[model samples]
Target: MRKAWALLALLGWLCGLAPAIAQVSLPADLTQRELVIGTRVAPPFSMKNAEGAWEGISIDLWRHLAERLGVRYRFEERDTVQALLDAVTTGQVDAAAAALTVTAARRQVMDFTQPFFATGLGVAVGRGGATAWLPVLRTFLSFGFLQGVLTLLGIALLVGTLIWLFERKHHEAYGGPPLRGFIAGAWWSAVAMTQAGAAQDGPRTLPGRILAVIWMVASVVTIAVFIAGITSALTTQRLQGVVRNVGDLRSIRVGAVSGSSTVDFLNAQTVGFESYGLPAQGLRALKAGRIDAFVYDRPLLAWTIQQDFPELEVLPITLDSQNYAIALPQDHPMRVALDVTLLDTLRSEWWTRTRLRYLGNDAAN
Candidate 1:
């Protein structure tokens, strides 16, 4: 068996971060010739469970790659997404795992192994849209967000005029009682956009006390509308889902299980990205400032954050519906090895064992 030198960190750098690696051939030091690859926990592909074990399609694939190449590999259980990516950049490890997909952006930075599996984009909504407000409620009753926007403009004018005449004429949006001003503006915006005929109240010489009273009432209604809008999106969609595009995710930092189809899709689309060799890495990246959005299969990530990472919420849209595939770095030596290995593995009894290990564990749900 040929020895594949798994290099870790460049020889020298002051930052103390990992270093980039340069491959070398082995000279009979099997134990010393071991490769340390950076990786994170990406479910149904690659992940280290609470039980302290490595299991998944990607893991098995690596194991086979190591054996056929006759090299020893020690899978490092990485903690953060950035560290995993950094490891690759700095040569802290031979290569990363966790369903990493190959992409042009990443290609510019790091090399990839051949693909191992395929997965695609998924969508999620907040706990469920609120079901009480008219604006929100109206969504279920054939509502449009455009109307709410119009109402807000009209209300702003009416209030702006009254302020110009009576109150803080020179004040900006949040210039007054910070709380009062925001609540006033926000509530007005919410109301104006959701309702019709809000133009009738064009600032007819109102007192502060009277305006305050109206603002309070408007705030309450706005809350109701917000709740209703959320509820409509959730339940209605569950029964008959709404359709949205990935374009909405332009500004978001989407996370994928490294080489999964979702990562591939987002990469192909040229949306902003933060790749994770593991779901845990991506989630950690989402927290540690690597990226803002983490895109995954809706079913896989639906309750994943709520359950495993409760701080995150499902955005309003799902980008696309596509298949899942395992991707390695393009032209990786492992590509031919893994591709042929995959065909054979699919027929072997070991395949189901591999599949059951991480098949249904979608972090989203």
Candidate 2:
């Protein structure tokens, strides 16, 4: 009985020890393992400095995590966010550290570490330019303006034909050849309606003169309506500004960074947008008036506007709020370890300090 009890106790002890041994052995080779980290230039998150060295919040975060894990890493630059995600998904790189947003679609292909940042879509637009007369003039000649003018002309022609019928028998001004008589009466009607009194004699018939007086009165109201419409159109074109929401995106030329969540959002909304490889490219396009607005991550656009493009403005609206996380291949060995470290780091003072250092006063909560 004593031997059997001792054997049972030993078995339990070995069972517990086996897990410890396995846990301890797992990271033993981590010190010798070199991880390939993929990244892109996404300012305030990850970027390559003028010295050709990586720097930013994401870079520092990865460096600290690697040091804590006793693992070595080398960063490979991907041209765009899509490229970075693809590298990790395909196992071409062990991990990706950038402003990669965590979404259900992406979660299916790869695993993400605990979220380190939260942000949403933003719209950036060029600063208001000098209010010029040329724009107003252009508005006046717009298609809508021409359509209104055509409608007014048609009304004037119909009224003129009525006046010609009433005055043609007795008034010399309407007694010429058929077409010429009609043209003369039309000119007289136009002059009277515009309050630009005609030099020709008055119609002999009372009905003709009565019709002229009525047309002159109606002209005042019609002219006022036309003027109001033109003014309203001009004001609308000048002050329309950037898109405040997805619905407003339809009428404007929009730009998005290639492979970003912005593109996905725009596509899902069926809002056509032009894609650029970098935010800088999109900003340049906006400045050059090639694109009316740029849509991207709100925090990134805010950081960029605060840092490099003060002339531009970010709309106060936000869309498709998302959390950004470090991406790793599905079921990667380091995924859980990284997530543990990342969660702890996010709750630490270091994360706050790092965010403040790069994001300035605009750090997201």
TM-score of 1: 0.46
Best by TM-score: 2
Query: 1-365, model 2: which lDDT tens digit per residue?
Result: 99999999999999999756433222555567788999988888898889989999889999998876678889999997888888988999988998899988899999998888888898888877532233466676678888989888887887788888888888888887889778977787777767776526557788888877788889889999898888787776655444546887876789998888888889999999999988989998888888888999988898888788877888777878889889989987787678767777788889899988987787756
Best by lDDT: 2
**Please, what are the lDDT tens digits per residue for candidate 1 over residues 1-365?**
12322233232342343321222233455435777766676555565668978866667767765665567778886665556666776767766766454556666776654344544456432333331122234355544555664565566556544443444444354346645655554554344434544632223335743774675477567657766776666566454322246654564445566555576677678876766665556766665545655777654564366657765556556565543334333344444444555565556666566665554453221
Q: What is the TM-score of each candidate against the true structure?
A: 0.46, 0.64
Model 1 lDDT vs. the true structure? Answer: 0.55
- Window of ten residues with lowest summed lDDT in model 1: 17-26
State the number of backbone clashes in model 1: 62
